[model samples]
Target: MNQNQSFRQLWISQSIANLGDSFYILAIVTFIYNRTGSAAFAGLFPILRVCAQAISGLAAPLLMDRLRLGTLLWMAEMGQTICFGSMCILYFFLPSQWLIPAVLFLVFAISMLHGWAIPVRNALVPRLVPSHLLVKANSLLATSDQIVLLVGWSLGGILVAEWGVIRVLEITAIMMFFSTLALLFVKDPSANVSAQPESQKRWDRMKEGWITIWGNPILRTLSYMEIISGLGESIWAGSIILVFVKEVLHKGEDWWGFINASNFAGTILGGLLIWKLSKKIENRMLFTMLISSFSIGVLTIAFTYSSNPWFALGVALIMGPPYQARSIAQRTLLQFHTPEVLLPKVFAAFGTILFVTFGFSVLLMGWMADQWGIRFVYMSTAGLYVLSAFLTLMMMKKASRSIQTQKEERYMNKIE
Candidate 1:
């Protein structure tokens, strides 16, 4: 198939897989809580999943170096499908004492495979689309992601209640099967077309991405920004948000859901705005990213101080566009700056950083919420955002000066 067809297949596969993921996660969390009657047990699901994904990301360069991106993606989906299908069977046959552990193991296994899929899929976009279309492509992908999250989570709970957990798992398995099938048509000629030298050590291959990030000034700066932002973004974690709704807003579970939905809606709007302004944004990615970063910092503070539920909802909605803009710009910048051969590994390293930071940040933010207040957790996150923005500004100036030096050297060579 042609590049356009391949890209379409990739997009469809991701959308379907994400929808299945939503159902699968909701089913598993609900099942665990219902069976155990413990919020702590249910919470372990995310904790385990994050840890597993981080571990997998750290090792993903090994696979990315050997397999085509298309192959890696489809295999990840297939592995998830098999794991979920097995979970459905084990639910019926396994003894009560063994079932939760079995299910949790399967969850971790599935998440490990997912860790590989994310970087592979992201690395495929630059190969499929021209550089000029990178912003629009990333915007479309982000929009679909938000849409899937909104639809899947909004409908998943109801579906689980109606269909029962086992049936929902079965349906998700089927959806994943189709996602794998769609991925079968995807082609990424840029990946794994040649064998690596036998002299390269496995340890060296694994650390290659981290080395690349360290050597590149832009990637290093971006990594620092992501680390800071990831910590700040943890304030949006469900547990923190739920607590804020209860303790600060004096609101019910429905209000929590409303706030979440509003945030999703705002992100969807933001994605559309980015898509519409893709050309302009493409030319000034750093500037756009900087502005969006500051906007999010300001909006987040506004969100933290609002006692009125409706006002908080509005602030959450306003937060979406800048958030989307910054995300697309960052992603596009990474794609443009990294070489095709190294992009997947670089993305893997970046994913690992995010996973690690987010995991720690969740725990840190949870403690702050308990010790101080939910408002304090958000206020501190806003401070982190401001720090992140200034860092980006510094990086931009350094990059500009580097470019000027290059131009002047070329002019001197011409004069000689």
Candidate 2:
């Protein structure tokens, strides 16, 4: 297949996988809660998944170095499918005393395999599309992702309600199987294994991405922003949002759903808007990102003060465009700045940081909400975003210079 066809396959495969993921998450969480009758046990689902993914991410670079990106992705998808299929059978036949543990183990296993999916997908984008189309491609993928999240989560719970947990799991497995098949058509032009000095240590290979990220000013700045933003974004967690609806808005579960739906809708709109303006925004990505971060920070603060659910929904809706714009800008910049061969490792290193921050921030935000209030949690998140914006501002010159240097190097190579 040509690069364009491969990209289409990649996009379709990822969308399908993401939809399946939403269903799988809802099914397992509901299944666990119903079986155990404990919210704490149910909550362990995300925690375990995050921890497993983080671990997997730290080790993912080693695999990325050896395998073709396409090979790694399909294998990861297939592994997840196998794990989910196993969980379905065990859930039916396992003894009562052993069911929860067995299912939880499978969840961890599946998540570990899934850790490779995002970084690999991000790495593959640059290889598939020309540099000029990177922003458009990223925006398109982001739009599809939001649509999947909106449709999948909205429908997933209902499907679980109507068809039951096992049926949802079965459906997810089938989707995943097809996702794997779609991946088979993708050709990795940069599939050659990266050679290392024979005497190099395994530790050096693992740390290569981290070193590259830290050494590059743009990537370093981006990493700093990611850490700060990850902490702030934890407020969007379902538990936190649920508390916000109940305590601040004095609203019901339906309002929580409404608010979440509004956010997704806004994001889809934002993605489309960005997609259309991608060419205009490409050269100004950093500036656009900074502005978007500031907008999100201000809007999030505004959201915290709203007692009326309608006003809060408006705030949530308005926040989506900036959020989506910021996300796409950041992703495109990462792809633009990093070498394609090292993209997987850079993404893996970046993913590990995100998982760690998100895991920690979730717990920290929960504690802050418990102690101060749900509003306080969001206010704190806003503060983090503002801090991130300032950090970006401080590094803007250096990032620009780095971009200039990279362009010069590329030009020189072409001339030679």
Candidate 3:
């Protein structure tokens, strides 16, 4: 297959995998809570997933360097297929009391593999398309991802409630297996391998991504913002959102599906808008960061106070564009700035930060939900976004100054 056609195939495969991920997450969280009747218990699953992701992210760059990108993609998909397929079988045969532990173990395993899969997928995109088309490509892929998410989030709850979680998981496994087949037609891209000390310490090698981020001012600021934003974004933990729907909004499983689907519908719209306006978006990074933080703050506050489910859905729809724009911009910026040799490590570090911060935030928010109410937790997340907005504005100024200085330095070097 040609490069463009291969990318399209990869995108479709990943979209299917994304749908499976969404389905399994909603199904598993609801399953846990339905059985245990504890939001805290359900919360543990997200923590488990993120914690495994964080650990795996630390090693993702190493794996990416050692293995073919296509191999990583196929391996991750096949691994998850096995994990989910095993869960489906075991759930039926295992003792009732063993279900939770068994599910948790598989979730952790799937998540660990996922940690490797996502960064590899992201890093592979730039290789698939030329620099000029990167923005459009990212936008289209993001939209596809969101569309699948929209379907998965919307249908997952209803399916779980109607057909049962085990059945949903079985279907998810089948989808994952199908996704793995697509990679067989695509050729793996060569890595931009960099030289390293022959005797470099393992710890130093492990810290390569972190060290790179620390050395780059823009990456440093963006990485910090990601961590803080993650804290605010913790409200998206499945159990917490489910609790909000059930306890605060007094809704059912369908409502949970509706709310999440509404959020993802907004994401798809936002991706389309960004794709159309790619040339018009001057200073993409600053605009995305500022708008993202501001919109998130506004939506969080609006959703927090809204008593009606429809009103909450309306707010969710409005939040979509800024969220999509910010993600697209951040990704574009990373690809534009970081060299290919270092990009995997940089992305690995960024993912690790997000996973670690997001994981703990979910656990902490889960406890707070029990103590202070889900509404309070939602409002608190809004406060975090506000802080993120303020910080991002400050960083924008810093980035502009850095860009100007670098331009002058390059001009002087040319003259010399």
How high is each candidate's TM-score? 0.97, 0.95, 0.86
**lDDT, residue 313, candidate 1:** 97
- Candidate 2: pairs in clash: none
User: In candidate 2, what are the lDDT values of residues 69-147, reduced to their tens digit?
Assistant: 9999999999998988898888778898999999998999999999988899999999999989999999999999999
Worst 10 residues of 2 by lDDT: 191-200
lDDT of candidate 3 over 1-416, digit per residue (tens): 37787788789889989999999999999889998999989978877887899999897766665567778778988999999999988877999999889989999999999888888778778888777778888899899988887788768878988999889999999999889998776665665444465577667777888888898777887787788767877787667889999987899978886787788889999999988887766356676778788888888999998889999889888888888887888788777778777777788888999888887787799899999899899989888878878877887888788889999999999999
Instruction: State the local distance difference test value for candidate 3.
Output: 0.83
Which has the greatest TM-score? 1
Per-candidate clashes come to: 0, 0, 0
| Candidate 1 to native Cα RMSD, angstroms | 1.3
For candidate 1, write residues 255-289 as lDDT tens digits: 99999999999999999999999999998999988
Ranking by TM-score: 1, 2, 3
**Candidate RMSDs in order:** 1.3, 3.1, 3.3
Q: How many backbone clashes does candidate 1 have?
A: 0
Q: Report the Cα lDDT for residue 166, model 3.
A: 86
Q: Residue 131 error for model 1, in Å?
A: 0.7
